[model samples]
Target: MEIKLVPVRPEDKGTLINLYQLYEHDFSRFTNRDIDKNGRYEVNIDFYWEGDERWNPFYIEVSGTIAGFLVVLFENMDIDPDPTHVIYDFMILQKYRRTGIGRAAAIKAFKMYNADWAVTQMENNTPAISFWRNVIKSFKEDNFTERYRPERKKYIQELSTKT
Candidate 1:
């Protein structure tokens, strides 16, 4: 299956915003975040695109169709001097599940960033935990670390590219 991550552009904002709603819809099952009675979930999309140079968001495309989106940002969640690129949000359309598209997109992101990387899944999301564990395991095993951070209640996978 062909998969790609396209940098979301201004003209695509409307489409991305619409997809963001679905992302939140799926996340609700694993978190306490509330959706408004009107069925809207709050997010800072504009800020994500404008306010921070370190924040990057991409649209996941499967064979020329928008499948989902993910945010890869240079953040200090675990704090390392070498800089850390984190995959903050990842969503794949239900129609595209279990087809290796997510894996291909993630592997592309790893090569594109080519730095210390972090991917975290909320502890309650078992499917996510399993998916990420398998993905990390396929990479260079010597450079990866997987563990649950009790304070944040998140399962974290960190990849250190250092020799």
Candidate 2:
């Protein structure tokens, strides 16, 4: 399946509300949030509509259908003098997962930004750990840095195109 990363337009908001709820449900497993009686989860996305220049939202498309969405943000965590690309959120529909589309999309995303990369995944998500490990390894080999931040209970990885 071919994956296309299309910039999510304002008209796509309603669809994203549902899709994002799906993502929230899956993510709730790693956090304290619980699925409501209706089997739905609520995550405030008001900021996404604020039209922030620092944030980007994209719909993951497969064969003209919306497979999922990815939210990328330019954030200055001030780890250094330069701002960095942060993959704030990424979710591929359950049906489209485990295929090569995700890996391809991630590689494409990194190349599109191409400065510095900082990615975090909940430590409880072993599959995410595996996915990030594979992508970073293929993109940076042993040149990348990864550490398990005990305070956040998340795996943090840093990479640079220069490396």
- The count of residue-pair clashes in candidate 2 stands at 0
lDDT of 1 by residue, 50-149 (tens): 7566778899998899988888888863365557889988999998889888888888888886588889988889999999888778876666888888
**How much lDDT does each candidate structure score?**
0.83, 0.82
Give the poorly placed runs of model 1, Cα more than 4 Å off.
76-81, 161-163
- Candidate 2: give the clashing pairs: none
Please state the error at residue 148 of candidate 1 in Å.
1.9
For lDDT, the strongest prediction is: 1
Candidate 2 residue spans exceeding 4 A from truth: 37-39, 77-81
Give the number of the best model, judged by TM-score.
Answer: 1
Q: What lDDT score goes with residue 49 in model 2?
A: 68
lDDT of 2: 0.82
